[model samples]
Target chain A: MVLLKLFWSFLQIGLLSFGGGMAALPLIQNQVVDLHGWITLKEYTDLITIAEMTPGPIGINAAAFVGVRIAGVPGSIIATVGCVLPPFLIVLLLVRLYLKYKNLSAVQGALSGIRPAVTGLIASAALTILILILWGENGFSTNLESLNFVAFILFAASLIVLRKWKPNPIFIILGSGIVGGAIYLLL
Target chain B: MEKRKSIYRKLFSSTFYISAFTFGGGYVIIPLMKKKFVEGLKWIEEDEMLNLIAIAQSSPGPIAVNTSVLIGYNVAGLVGALVSLWATILPPMITLSVISMFYSAFIKNAVISAIMKGMQAGVAAVITDAVLNLGSNVAKKKELISVLIMLIAFIMTFFLKVNVVLIILFGGLIGTLKVVLHERRNKGGGE
Candidate 1:
């Protein structure tokens, strides 16, 4: 039952993941965290980190990673297959028809609209992660005590450093890991 | 003339090599695939690879895997596409399997947990940068309708709490409508 659930959830994720990998994050979060209760929001963020750090397409890596966490190797294979099967089939089909309508204005029109929406989708995803860091999932409650000042500070610093330097994400992630270990561990 | 079997062998081995070593995400692998197939192996022409990349990007999947399958199909056939897909997936599966083997134990370590907690901020930052970059790209396109749709989509998800799948469907529909109206206007004016 668990195996079937994992496969089905990831298959849905694979089918509708438009725009690109990062754009797919919110969708992945919705299925794994919101629907299946597979991982916490915090752990979901960490998985994004791990997925970003590892090689291959982030979506496939994520399916494997999340599946392993849920149910081990068999789970991993099943989930990974679920995640990839849609694209494998879709792309093959698209390639067959692509040469015909490669320049369809209606297609370009649809993309133009979807592209901005994907930007919004990523923005919304970023906001959710930001909220989780700054406040609990209760989402903007009146409690100041639960707020993580240190994390907020780090988040600000990271945003600035990324915009200014554009360092590779691996560095940003590892650097944060070191600093996080130093501050929180000592405190 | 290389035997048909060698084509699959070449696809598997070379794709495995690139996918194994390449880090980050799909975009990172494109150049490497280009270098190997376009420059080194000369299996595909430079222009053809560009077309494949564009189609791969426009399609609804991981660009790396999509590109792989396209290049594979170009090289061999459907079988080649399947082989390339597995080739692309195996390295990460191997790497993540080793990591997942120790995942529970790894999560338990105080040091690792703290580090990950800190990295969460980093992750948030990286995502923020993506939002800004993507948002700005849309903005740079300078379309009033596009910008409005972006804002409306953001408000819908972050504030109104609409399901993203619904938004994607609606967004695509609106996009098609936008084109149809524009084309109709052009035709009417021409007539």
Candidate 2:
């Protein structure tokens, strides 16, 4: 029964999470923290860190993390399955539809429109994280009181490295991780 | 042509490798997949890859997973899709399970948390770059409707906190309407 509940929670997460990893965090928080109280807000914040830090999708990582916390290995497995099931099925159906109607004007227009709108959501998500990291999570502020200059520097450096050298992004992430550790420990 | 069995193995291994190696978040994996499939393997065409990714995002669920399954199905079929999906999610499960064992210790570690904060800054950069790339691509199309949709969607999401699903649906509706009107206007010309 506990495992069943765990599965159901993550299943809802998979179904509802549309945009990307950052976009899904709130819904995951709502299910695991707010609704079920499976893990406290403190843990949810940690989950975000680990989820973003770790490989693959945040939704899958969160499911595995929470499942383990709640019900161990079996719980995590069940939750992970639940998390993936919806998208697995949904995308397959969409693929069939797209292949058939891809030539249609309506489909083309919808694709064009959704592409930009999706980009907008991604832009918003990036800003959300930037606000939290640079200004704290209370929303963007003009006071500059909580602005983190080190983070700003790091963000600038990473952007330059990415735009210029075009190395694998993993290198930038790992490099920033090291730089971030040194900066914060000194501060 | 390569044997179907070998192709399946290649697909599974490629996704598995990417899944295991990719860090930060889902979006990070996409460019890597494009590199592997479009450039490295030359199996999927450039526009085809974009179309698949677009559809993947158009549907619900994690965009990474959605993209992989679509790519897999596009390449190999349903069985290929299944292979890609499994390969994609397995790494996170294994890695997180181990991390969960040391959850408290991991969270409490000063160095790790500091690194996390730093990694987040880097992640923000990466994601911001991705946004810029996507935005510029939309801009390149030189379509006013999409540009306007992109702006409106940004305002709605950032300032208004609208659910992304609704925004996506709204975009789809607008797109459909634009094309329908376009077709009607052009119907008589039949050109």
Task: List the candidates' TM-scores in order.
Answer: 0.64, 0.84
Looking at model 1 chain A, report the run of 10 residues with the lowest lDDT sum: A113-122
Say which candidate scores most in TM-score. Answer: 2
Candidate 1: tens digits of C-alpha lDDT, residues B1-191: 46888989999999998787565566556656766788679999754665566557566767788899999998988889989999999998877766666765765688866876787777677767766766786788798988988899899988997766567656667888999999999999999
Give Cα distance to truth, residue B93, candidate 2, Å.
Answer: 1.1
Docking class of 2: medium
Q: Considering just chain B, what TM-score does every model have?
A: 0.56, 0.79
**Candidate 1 per-residue C-alpha lDDT over A127-164 given as tens digits, one digit per residue, 9 for 90 to 100:** 87678767855676567887887787888898899889
Relative to the true structure, how large is the alpha-carbon lDDT of every model? 0.77, 0.83
- Those runs of model 1 whose alpha carbons end farther than 4 Å from true positions after fitting are A1-79, A95-99, A141-143, B1-92
